[model samples]
Target chain A: MRWNYLIAGATAAIVGSTSGHATTYMTPAQARVAMFPSAASFIDRNVVLTPQQRSVVQKIAGIPVRAPKIMAWEAVDAAGKRLGWVIVDRVLGKHEFVTFALALDAGGAIKGIEVLDYRETYGDQIRNLKWRAQFTGKRHGATLQLDKDIKNISGATLSCRHVTDGVKRLLATYDAVLSDHG
Target chain B: MVLSDCLPPMMPSFQIMGELERRCRPLLGTFVEITAPHEKAIAAGFATIVKVQSLLSAHDPVSELSAVNRLGHRRSVTVDPWTAEVLQRALFWAEASCGAFDPTLGGLMAARGLLARNDSLLPLDPQANWRDVHVTNREVWLDRPLRLDLGGIAKGFAVDCAIDAMRAVGVQCGLVNAGGDIKGFGPEAWPVTIAMPGSREPLAMVELQNAALATSAGHDASGGLDMRHLAGASPAIASVTVEAASAMDTDALTKILVSATLKSVVCLGLAGASALTIFVDGRVIPFELKEPTA
Candidate 1:
C-alpha cells in the first residue's frame, strides 16, 4: 500500500509541475503581449470622455458607457513605432462578468481578442477559439452587431451579445479617442 | 474640435457618490474586481486582496500556508492573523460538515494531481482529517504530516478582507467579486444571477444587500472537469449556490452542502444559510435563509 501511494504521489508531482489550474489562463500583462506580439512596450493611457464624446460613443455603440472615463494601452514597438491598442473591458454574461482584451490596430481594426478572465459558472462558449477568431481584422467603423455581424454561440446568448456589444463600445471609443492619437 | 460649448459639463442629479470607482488586478489565480467610491478605497482593497493571496496561497512556495504545510507537524507554526481567522472558520465548517469540508485533503488532492505539491510530505495513508489540525490564536499545529489546501475558501475570505479595506477607507457602497464569489454592500441591493448549466438563461436571480453569494457547480457546468471530485464531494450533486452574511460562510457552505451525507443535513440546516442545490437529475432544492434569533 505504501509503495502504491509513493508511485501515485510521484506521478501526480510530475503532472502538477507541467499543468496549470483551470481558472488562470493569462494575466493582464501577459495578455497585452500576446495580443500585440510586435510591440515592445505598452503605454498606459486613461480617458475620461467629455460629455460630447460620451454622448457620441453611446450613440455609436448603442450601449451606455458605464464610467465617465475608461482606460486603454498603446502598444509601441522599437523606435517608437505603433503596433496597436489594447483595451481591457468587461461585459455582463449570463451571470457574473466576462473580461477580455480588445486589440485594435492603428487603422482601428481588431488585431486579436482574448478572454482574460471569465466569472460565470457556465456559458463560457464565448471563449471558443473559433468564435473569437471571427472578430479578428474586423474594422471599428463597421456595424459590428452581435448576431448581425458576429455569430452567436448556441447556448451562450448573453455572453455572445454582451461581448459583442462590449467590442462595439471599444471600437467606438477607439474611433473617438485613440484613432487620432495613434 | 473642442465641443465643450454644445454639451453640458456633467449630467444634473448624477450624484458624485453614486459614481462607481473601480479597479481590477490579477490575484489569487483569478481577476479581482474592486469597485468603490474613491481611488484610495480601491487601492486599499486591492492591496488587502494581494496581501491575503500571498499569505494563504498553497501554491506559492514562500507563502505562510506553504510553510505551515511543510513544518506544522514538527512544531506549532505561528501564522498571520488573517490566516488564523480563515483557518478557524475552515475548521468550524470542517467539523460542522462532518469532515465533508476537510482541509486536510490537500495531500490527497495533490496526490490526485488536482493541486501542485509544495515540498510537503504526502500522507502515505491519505486520511489526514481536519480534526488532526489544530489552531490557537495565531499558531497552527498539525498532529500528523498532512498538507492543508485552503483553495476552497481562501478566495472568499480575501473578498471579505477587501470589503473590510473598503469600509476602512470610508467607502460603503461597493462590491468585491473575486471570480464570482461576490460580496455586495450599501443601501441599494446588488442584483446577482446564477447561470444554469448548459443553458443561456439563469437558474436564479437574487439581490444581495450587504451580503455575499457563492456558487459551486460541477466542472462540466462550463464544459470543464468535475472539480468537486477532487474534494471527495458527492457525485450526485450538479451545483450548489449559497448566500450568507459573510462570503466565508457561503464559500465553505457550498462545498459542505454538495458533499455532506444525508445524515449531516440536519446539522447543515441548523447552520442557518439559504441555498439552492441542483442535483444531477434536475431536481432542485431551495433552503430559505433564516435569521439567527438572539
Candidate 2:
C-alpha cells in the first residue's frame, strides 16, 4: 500500500501533479531553465490539462498530498514487474498539443505507453484503443517509424505522426534521465 | 391477480417479454410478441407467458441444468421437459446454421471479457469459449465455467414464443418485435418492412400471410463485433435479414446468409420459409415459402 520515499516523490511528482491543491506550477521560465534544458523550449511550451482530466487522474492516484504542476514526468519501477507508474508531459509541437506518457517497468523497459492526450485532429484515430494496443509489448529497442513501424488510421494522419514523434521524444528524455540516475 | 402478480402491464398486449425473461433469465431477447392482443385474452395469454418463463429460467439454486452450466465437466444431469425441448431446438438450430446460431456462444462471449457484471463492472478477463459449454439431456454442462451471453438468439426465441402465445389466445393477427428481430402472423397477410441495415429508411416491405418472418442485420450503430463469427470475415457488410418459418429459423439463418453465396438462398426455401434476403448493397434476394416438412 505504501511506496518507498523516492518512488513516492517521483510518483507524487508525476501522479499528483496538477491535482486540486494549488502549488507552485512549473512556469515556462522555470521549466525552460531547470528541467530537460535540451528540450526546455519545447517542454515549457503551451500546456493545458482540463480539470476533468486532472480529476480523473486524482481519483486514480487516491493521494491528497499537495504537489507542483509538472510538465515533465519520470516514473520509476523499483522492482521490475508490471507497469509501475506512468510519467506524462505536455510538449508543445509545431501544429498541435502533444501530451504523452512514458511507462516504465521494474527493469526500466517501456512496458506501456499512451499518447496520453493530443489535438492533432487529422489521421490520429490510431490512439483510440486500436493504435494504443500496438505499444503493449513495446520496449526501448522497438522501432519508432511513423510510416512502417506504427500504422496510422487513415483519417487521422496528423495524430499518427504526432504520437509516433512524441513517443520518440519521451524515449529520448527517459534515456537522458536513466543515464544520469544510474 | 395472476398476471399482475408476476408482471406490470407495459402495454395492453400479451406480456410476452415478461414471460420470456421470467422463464429465462440471462435470456437474450425477452420482449417479443408471440400472442395477439385482445382485451379479454390478456389474463389467459399473459399467464401462459409467465408459466413458460418460470419453466425456462436457470435461477433455481439446485437446478440440475444450472449446476451443469455453472459447474461443468460433469458426467450427466437430468433436465426438465421444457428446458430439454428448448435445448433440442437450440441444438437443431446450431447444426442448421453450421455453428452460426449456437447456444454454446455464451462461453465465448464470456471469454471475450464482453460480459458486464450484475454491478455493471466488466470482468478483468472475459474471453469466452464456445467449447466450454456442453449440452446433454437434462444437463447443460460445460467444459469449463465461462460467462454465457445470449444476445441475438434469445430475442428470436422470445418472439417465437409470443407468436405461439398469440395464436393460443385466439387472436389471429399479431406482431412480436424484440429490440429488432420481429415475427408476425397476420389474420390474412402481415405487411412487414425490412429496413436498410444502417439507414433508417425502409428498403423493402412484404406481406407475410401464413408464416413467420425474422430479420437479422449484423448492423450496429457503432459496428463493434460483426464479422467475428465468420471465417476470415472483416466486418465489412452492414446487415443481413432472413425470413424463415420460425423466428429461430430466421434468426439462425441470418448468420448463414451473411457468409453464404447466391447458391445458399435456395436452402432457405428448403427450410420452409419464403426468402427475402437484403445486403448493404440494397440488392434483395426474394424467395417464396417452402413446402412444409418436420
Candidate 3:
C-alpha cells in the first residue's frame, strides 16, 4: 500500500505510566510487576506455553486463560534451598506474536506449559515446538539461557530470547515471593 | 615572441599553455573543450582532468547508486550514463560508507544545500521513492515528485567525456587528465606519477599506454587531508585504483570503491572491466575482466 507518510521524526519523551510498577525483582520486569500491579495489568496480562504443558496448567486451574492475573503463590521445601513456583505473565519480543501459559512446579521446576494463542511472521522460534519438549525431565530453576541449554532456532535470536526472558521473570518472581512467604 | 600581444611585454615566449600553468582553477561547473596539438600528448594530459573531478565533494546522504535506469528518482532528469559508470565503480567506497555514498539520497542532498542549481528546489512529497524514475536510451522520466542531483559523479563523467571528445577532435597522441581521472590514447611509453602520499617516494610512476588510471587521494594547499568525497563513501580504505576500458570507468570507480567494497567491485568486474581494490591495511585485491557466471 503506497500510503502517504506525513509523520516527521519525533523527539518527545513519552513518560511511561508503568514506571511506578517496576521494582526490586532481579529482572526489570519483576520490578515493573511488583511496584505497579495496576499499571502492569495494562500490558503484560499474558504468558507463553506449549501444548502438553497447556493442558497441564489448564487442567489444574480450569481454563487458565480467563484466570485474573494471578498474584500467584510460592515457597521452598524444608531444605531451604532454591525451590518454589509462580505463574507470572510476560510477552515475547519476537515479531512473531505468540502468547500462552507457563507454570513452574513445587521444586521450582517447569511443571507444564500450554500455548493459548499463536501466529508467526518468519522462521519458527518457539513455534517449531521445541520449548516444551526440551524442558521435559529437566529440573526446575535451571537458568533459562536458551542459546546455551535450549535449541533456539537460528535467525530467531530475539524471538528465542523473548520466551527465555519470560521464563527468567517467572523464576525470579518465584524466588522473590517464596523467600518472603517462607 | 613578444609577451605584449597577450601578456606583459617583460615575459618570454608564451600564450595559452603558459597562462594555464600559472593558474589552474578547479574545473568544476564549467564545460571544457581541449585545443591541443598531437594525439598521444592530449591522451596523456588527462592527469590534469583528475584535479578537476575532486572539487565536486560535498556531503550527500544516501546509498550511492551502483547502476541503473537512473541513480535514483532525482536523477531522472538526464541519462547521465557517465554518472552510471562512476556509481558502478564506487562500490568499494560504498562498502566503506555502509550506505552513505548512496546516489539514492536525492532528498538528503536537497536538504543539505549541496544540490547545485537548486533555486527551484521543492520539498519532495512524502510519498517520493527512489524507484519512481524510469530511464531508457532516449529519455528519462521523473514521475510524480522526485528531485535528483548527480553532483557526486558528474565531474568524473565530464572528465571521461572530455577525454573522448579530445580524441574525436584529432588528438592522435595525448591524455585527458581531469585532475585524477586520466585516459591515455596513442603511444605506450609516457611517464605518469601516481603522487599519493605515503605510497612511496617515486609515487608508483607508470608508463602510459592505451590505458586509463585513477588514484583516489588529494591534499589541500595547507597539507590538510581533503577527504570530502572519500569520507562520503566510508570505505576501509584511504584510496582505491581502477583501470578499465575507459577513463570514465576508472574515475567514478574510485568513489564507488571507497565505500561499496565487495558489492561494487564485483559489479564492475562482472560488467567486464579490470579492477583492483586497496584496503586501509594496504592489502590489494585485484579483479580481472571476465565473463561472469550466474
Candidate 4:
C-alpha cells in the first residue's frame, strides 16, 4: 500500500500539473460570489504577518504557521457592509494536495468551504457539500478535530484530517490577522 | 449595480481578467475541471457535469442509475434519454473491448467493497456479462443479477457533454479535463503531459489537437496492485494511455489496451486513435495507429 502511494504520488505530481495544468475549478471572483452572492464588491490584499503576528496565529490556530504570507480577499455589499473573507489555501492529501477556499464572516465564523482543485484519485469525499457544511458556523477557538467534530469519510481519512487541520489554521489566521480589523 | 463604487476609498477595486476561467467541482467520484471563456459558458459546462453525475452516479442512492440497478434486474426499467445514450455507448465499448471493459463488474466491485451497494442483490452470476444486458426503446434489462457500473466510461462521456455545452454557449476554444481523461475542442490544441506511473515528472508531452486522451494505471484506487482483469491481459504494463477522436472512445480504449496482450494490442488499433503502454520495468510501447477492421 505504501509503495503504491509513492507511485501514485509520483504519477500525480506529473499528470496533475503539466503545461495545460492551470485547471481552475473556480476563479477567485466566482468563489467570492458563490460564497457571498449579494456582495457588492471585493478587496484583494496580500498579507505577510510579522514574526510576532505569525506566532500569535500559530498559537490561535494550534498549527504551525508556515509561509506567514498569504493573499486574502474581503467581500462587501453595496451598502459598504462587510460580507465575508475568502482565503484560498492548499493542503496535502495522500497523493497530491487539494486547493480550497475558506470563507469566513466578519465575526470569524465559517460561512462555507469550496474545493478549487483536487488531484488525488481517492480522498475526494471532502468535496461533498454535506461534509463542508459541518464547518459552517464554526469560529476560532473551536475544537476542529477530525472524527470528533468533523466527520471522517471512510476512504478519505488522510484528506479529512489534513483539511480539518487546514481549516483550524485558517480560522486561527483570521482570529490573529483579520478579526478585529476590517 | 456598480457595487465597486459603494466601497470605501480604502478598499481597492478588483479587476477580473475576462480570459478563460476554469472551475473544478467534486463529481463523478473525482474532481471535474471545466474551462471556458466566460461565466455563462463555465456555468453551462458545470451544469452538464452535474447533470451527468446526478443521472449516472452508482454511489448516489437517488441517482437514476441506482433506480435502474435496483429494479432493472427484476423488470425492464425505462431511463432518461441521457441515461439511455450513455448506456448505449457503454454497451458499445463493452462489446468493442470484449468484456474487458465490462460495466457488469459493479457487482464484483461492490462485493469487494470497492463500491457502495445499490441494492441487496449481488451480481454473483459468472455468466452475467455485457452480452446479457438488453437495451431497447430507451429501456434496459439485465438477463441476470449483475449491477452495472459506468464509472470507467461515464466520466469521459460527461467530458464530452461539457464540451458540447461549451460549444452551445459560443465558446470557441476550451477543454474539460475530468481527472486524467481530457477532451480538447474548438480551435486551439491544448498541450498535455502524460505522467509516468509513480513519477513526479512527465514521461511524455503531446499537443492535444481537438483530441481525447484517457490513461489507466496498474495501481488501483487504494494505491495497490490492480488485480482487475487487466492482470491477465498484460501483467508487464504499469500504465496505458490512449488518444482517440472522442473521450468516450479513449476511455474505453484504455481499458482494452491495459488488459490486452501485445499481439491483441496491435490488433485493436482504430483510425484517429493511438495508444502508448509503459511497463513496470520502464519499457514504453506505442501501438500502431490504424483503423480497426470490423
**Which candidate has the highest lDDT of all?**
1
| C-alpha DockQ for predicted model 3 | 0.00
lDDT of each: 0.65, 0.40, 0.39, 0.64
- A87-144 per-residue lDDT for model 2 (tens digits): 4555444334545455554355655433333332212211123322232332112111
Highest TM-score, which number?
4
TM-score of chain B alone in model 4:
0.85
Candidate 3: tens digits of C-alpha lDDT, residues B1-294: 111112211111123222221111123432122324542333333333433343223322222222222333345434345334444434333343444444445555545543433344444655654344454543455564555444445555655666566666665544444445555565433334343222111112334456766666533323223444343655355455566656555655665666654566464554344544444443434555446432
**lDDT at B155, model 3:** 54
TM-score of chain A of 1: 0.64
Colliding pairs, model 4? A7-B198, A10-B199, A24-B22, A25-B23, A25-B24, A26-B23, B271-B291
lDDT of 3 by residue, A1-182 (tens): 00011011100110111111011112334423332333313222233344544454455433233322444433334444323333545353323343434445546666533223333322221121232233233212212221112110101001133444455555544443333442
lDDT of 4 at B13: 12
List, residue by residue over B56-134, the lDDT tens digit for candidate 2.
4333324343444554543444666556656666666555555555555544444444332222213322343454455
Would you list the rank order by lDDT, best first?
Answer: 1, 4, 2, 3
Per-model TM-score versus the true fold? 0.61, 0.46, 0.41, 0.67
Candidate 1 lDDT by residue in tens digits, B179-261: 56788788766645454333322333455668887777643335533553337667776667777778887777777877747
Tens-digit per-residue lDDT, A1-182, candidate 1: 00000112122232223221113335678778767777989999767889988988899999998776676899999878888888888777444466778888877898766567655433334322232233233211112111111110111112144677788998998888778862
lDDT of 2: 0.40
